[model samples]
Target chain A: MKKPIRLINLGKTESWKTQAVYHALAEEMTDESPDTIIICQPDSPYLCLGYFQPFDSIFDRKNVELLNLPVYRRRIGGGATYLDENQLFYQFIFHHSRVPVALEKAYKTMLAAPVETLKSCGLDCNLRAVNEIEVNGKRVAGIGGGRINDAAVVVGNFLFDFDFEAMSTVWKAPWPGFRELAKDAVKERVYTLKQCAPNLRMRAVSDKLIELFPKYFNRPIVSGSLSQKEIMASQKTAQVLTDKIFLNDGNTDIPVQPRPLKISADVFIHNKKMFFKNKKINVSFRTDNDVITRVKVEGAVEIEKTIIGITIEEIEHILNSGSSTVLKDN
Target chain B: MSKKDYNFPADLHYDGKNHMWVKKENDNIVLVGIDAIGLDTLGDLAYITLKPEGTIVKKGEPIGTLEAAKMTGDIFAPVSGKISAVNAACVENPGIVNDDHYGKGWMVAIDASDWSTESTALISGEKLQPWIEAETHRMETQGFDA
Candidate 1:
């Protein structure tokens, strides 16, 4: 028998939408369900950084705090987001069985269904290999997803409205140069559905998701909720993610130090970070060539699990083409 | 120039664990480089560090590592031998990895005479292609980055 499709509605909420969806999907792990969908929105606007990106790269702590919105670093790869109430977010928790696991391929696969849905709305949206969907060269939607154990949830927002200026500028560091390009990259790369379409309503877009998903899916869709167990796990996970350490500067700087021995070289190229700022091994690698064939980590008395043995060939592929995200079997 | 028909170099190979591949140009001859796909996903690398040559290294030794964004992944040796050369071009411009992975992206060369046992672990280009394609698919579902 086809399981009933799990349909949830989160009209408008202030918390991180991605966290909410992830929490919901994590909650459903107790039983294997065919499908579960949670429609939610954040209480206010905030930055959402990709899982692998440093938190500092995308947000300003003081600015965000004053605005009263929280920042969330998700487990999915891709750029961050500035989500607010004007935007309606949707996360459909489907089994990894939803598609074969190829990071790039899976990214493409998850996009097809949504793009098809957008096309049905009379918008000529197409998926770009760069992990974006666009109309007339303007991005209409940004997408990224990964799997944990058995399920994969690709969550995104259908922009009902957004403040482009706010997104374009905020939390910017006082770097010496390249400020303008960075800002432009953010604006050019990101866009809202409403801004791109300028015609579609939030309800219509959400409805399209429900209608089109069933057509291509091979499994049952069942309505479900976040079980208590999942909520507990999510809260714990959230606490760790929200930890102050991760919120500070990436801490990637390797200061000039005396402990690791500042083997100074006349080679000039990498001037961004200095080794041993004050005679201490800061957490940074020293690279003279374009490639890193060795690592010098200071402040670490001992290598806990130093990745010493794996050859560059073995890791090169894993680090470059390979991608991973957290999704539990529900 | 016609691209060097890239292959999983014989001497330098993978244990399929998570390191790099290397090759022997001479008995002690060596060339170090990352497998093709590895370069694809490590976008716009920011930093790298390699051990200097003449260093007597063990089989599973820390050759170096690459960092992108905030996350850093280690680069391991295909075989353990003395360090010969480390690519210095990657110093100022780490983008060579994403731009020219095969030629300019070569990491380090080691003149190791004992890569025979280690060579066994490296995946062959002929064999690696299918495996990587399959692995790529596995990565997406399992939450692995590719």
Candidate 2:
């Protein structure tokens, strides 16, 4: 006997509603409530912070305020992200007993539907690492999962388009050149469905997900609306999501030194401005699994070629030693 | 690590449901932390936050939250009590919990209000080994390595 899962297809919603709907469902879920899958798109843009990611450490508050972007703190763990209408959100809320206890296995199970859906849309994509989905080495989706009370929740999106500039500009860069470096790195590593499958319609993608998810999970789907209690819970959860204190909560005082912007499971951008020979030198580089894969140095061109194949520790040693041999004739 | 290799210290009382261990510091004070099996299943932790000192929490309520890369789970209270102290070091650097889960990773000290009644629900003494064996078996059945 297959258990029936509720399908709540909210076509387009207020920005907060997109996040709050799933959160409310998870918070109020009990053994009696049916497992649910929610698909929705936000009508506007908002900045979402991870559950444990401190706001001050991740975002440029002044720029965020100037842009008038609403900031929300979701209970899921992940890096802070810029969300807008260009992405379709899929949120799954299941009782803890229904999903795999191991986080890795849980992600593989939940992401199977989206991976298959993207493939049907004429894109070659698969789940990478624990949760991210990628096509030809470029990430095509944003994913996050966590436990909220007794409910195990997984949320992700299909990117129709993304504003790389907005994402980079809003981040609190440790160095002046960091934003541009981040933007270029992200643009290189992320992809949109429209860019890959230009002929595919968003509705077709949604319909395919609706049809395929129940089959993948072996659960019959019953299209339904939120119960009155769930509606009230969502309204209240929205207030908590946008609360200033909640946004500012967590360890905000941690110093931002070598802030590494994670581009993928193996790619990270480390930016810092080092002082040597009474001259301030801007340093930006990308690391693939702790080894320097690329290097950009503002003060010395020679150091770039020298440090490309070295580990971060080796470069730090060369830079910190104030070795005139490396910095000479700059 | 295999199920038999995971540590379940003999002195601590374990909450099989939440995978937390409680150590009775005194009659009213009990120190709490997640067990080895729980940490093994969670993977490397990145961040942690606990209820502030002096906050009263009910049994099974969230005392704090722990996050790995993109997955977060709550640390539920093993016994109802007022939080006497929170481990600030663990909050600052959560990796220590991965390194020394039973030692420096201890999450909170609770001034328990209902020790006698709540203590009975916790598994300890002769029952600890059997309960852990069952739990590890259950996790393995759910596609997780012990």
The numbered model that scores best in lDDT is 2
lDDT of each: 0.54, 0.84
Per-residue lDDT tens digits of candidate 1, residues A1-330? 554557666666647434745744643543365456677767767677655445555455566666666667665545555667776666656665444433455556555667787788887777765346666555665455543334565666665566665654554433312233334444554556666677787777777776766555544455466667656676676765555555442443211111111111111111122223344222222222233323333344353135334343433454454245111110
lDDT of 1 at B132: 64
**Which whole-number lDDT from 0 to 100 does residue B55 have in model 2?**
91
lDDT of 2 at B84: 99
Docking class of 2: acceptable
What is the iRMSD in Å for candidate 2?
4.7
lDDT per residue (tens digit) for residues B73-127 in model 1 = 4566767778788787864467776576557877777887576666766676577
Task: Give the Cα error of residue A231 in candidate 1, in Å.
Answer: 1.8
Q: Candidate 2: DockQ? A: 0.44
DockQ for every model comes to 0.08, 0.44
What are the per-residue Cα lDDT tens digits for candidate 2 across A1-330?
Answer: 667889999988889889999999999888788999999999999999888766777899999998889999899887788999999999999988788777788888888899999888767788888888998768998898998998999999989999888898899876656676678878888898878887777788889998998768877889999889899999999999898877876343222223467776777888766555567787788888899877777767676786688897887677577666333211
Query: Looking at model 1 chain B, which ten-residue stretch has the lowest summed lDDT?
Result: B137-146
What does the lDDT read for residue A180 in candidate 2? 69
